[model samples]
Target: MIELVACDMAGTTIDEHGDVYVALARCVEEIGVETTPEAVQEWMGADKVEAITALIQAGGGAASPGIVAAAFTRFKELLVEFYAANPPVALDGVEEAFRTLRGQGVKVALTTGFSRDVAEHLLASLGWSVAAPGVEAGDPGKVLDAVVCSDEVPAGRPAPHMIHRAMERTGVQDVRAVIAAGDTVNDLAAANNAGVVAVGVLTGKLDREALAAHPHHHILDGVKDIPALLSFPN
Candidate 1:
């Protein structure tokens, strides 16, 4: 039985409509690194600072600490402002899936590659936030068990820290009893690295072919199928 479900934000739970990539391209361009939405999609689950550094380096530019910091700060400012003006919407079936999982005694945690401030802005915009672990009573239909951000972990996706932090915070003792689902390869990689069931959903930027290239236990049409996956005997 899965005790917890670790989900990714943006493409996974929240529908950004390519805003993150747009902001990413604009931010890196300020530092002389020209990139495209397709390029930014490759770093979907990575920390923004690391992604910016890599993009700059790929463009034959030095990723100076100062430059990275400045670009990251600019990206955050742009993203927050963009979201404020055009708030993101939750993907179809997300709220229903979360409620279903909680009804079955599964903790639902939302993890993101974005920094804490950005994550908070997203949560606030959606009128959702991380509930304290072990809270006995709350609107299980609406509250999340935890929210893990890249800034809170030593590293982001493909490193397992975010998943580990979510598990730690939600009191999920066994990796076998966890399910990590997202719409990117990095999300699948991170779940594999963390030794949990890696589920790929086709609700985001990545296509079936791209997600199939990664290690995963199952690939679903969307996260709405997750609750069904949990209902099976393990």
Candidate 2:
């Protein structure tokens, strides 16, 4: 049985209308590095700094720390404004699924590639707070057991630090007891690196072909099917 589920935010849980890639592409372009949305998509589950670095490298520029930092700062500003202007919507059945998992003594944590500020902003818009099991605040429908972000760790997805941090914060020691779900290859790679179940969901930018090209344990139509995947008899 899965004791904890570490889910990705933008595509897997919250629907942000592809604003993340847009902001990333815009920021990189500002630095004279023209990039396509598909280029940014390749690093969807990575840290913004890492993503910016990749963009710089891809566009034949030196991905210095200074350049990555500058690009990322601008990306944060743009992303914050974009989300504020157009608040995101939760995926269908996400909240219900959280409640169901929590009710079954299973911990549910929302992990994201975005930094804490952006993550908190998105959570606040959804009326959710980042807290542990008993000290939750805000809309009960939107509460999660924990929230882990890329900035909190040394590295993000495909490195497994975020997943390890989520497990640490949630007090789950065994990797076999966790399941990581998201809409990109990076998410699956992270889970695979962490030695946990890697689940792919189709609600994000990548289609089945893209996701299938990566390593994963299972594929679901959407996160709503997670409960069934876990054999939760409700």
Per-prediction TM-score: 0.94, 0.94
Put down candidate 2 lDDT per residue, 1-234, tens digits, no spaces: 788999999999999988898999999999888898778888998888888898899999889888888888999899888887887999998887777777777788988989998888888888876555554324585458889989999998889988888899888999999999999989999999999999999999888888988889898888888887888754
Per-model tally of clashing residue pairs: 0, 0
Instruction: Provide the RMSD of all predictions against the true structure, rounded to 1 decimal.
Output: 2.3, 1.9
Tell me how far the alpha carbon of residue 202 in candidate 1 is from the true structure, in angstroms, after superposition.
0.7
Error of 1 at 205 (Å): 1.1
Pairs with backbone N, CA or C atoms under 3 Å apart (clashes), candidate 2: none
Candidate 1 C-alpha lDDT tens digits along 1-234: 789899999888889776888888788998787776667888887888888988888777788999999999999988987887888988888877887777678998998889988988888878776656565325643568999989898888789989989889888889999999999888999999999999999998888888998889999988888977767321
Reference-based lDDT, residue 48, model 2: 82
Worst 10 residues of 2 by lDDT: 130-139
Instruction: Estimate every model's Cα lDDT from 0 to 1.
Output: 0.85, 0.86
lDDT value, candidate 2, whole model? 0.86
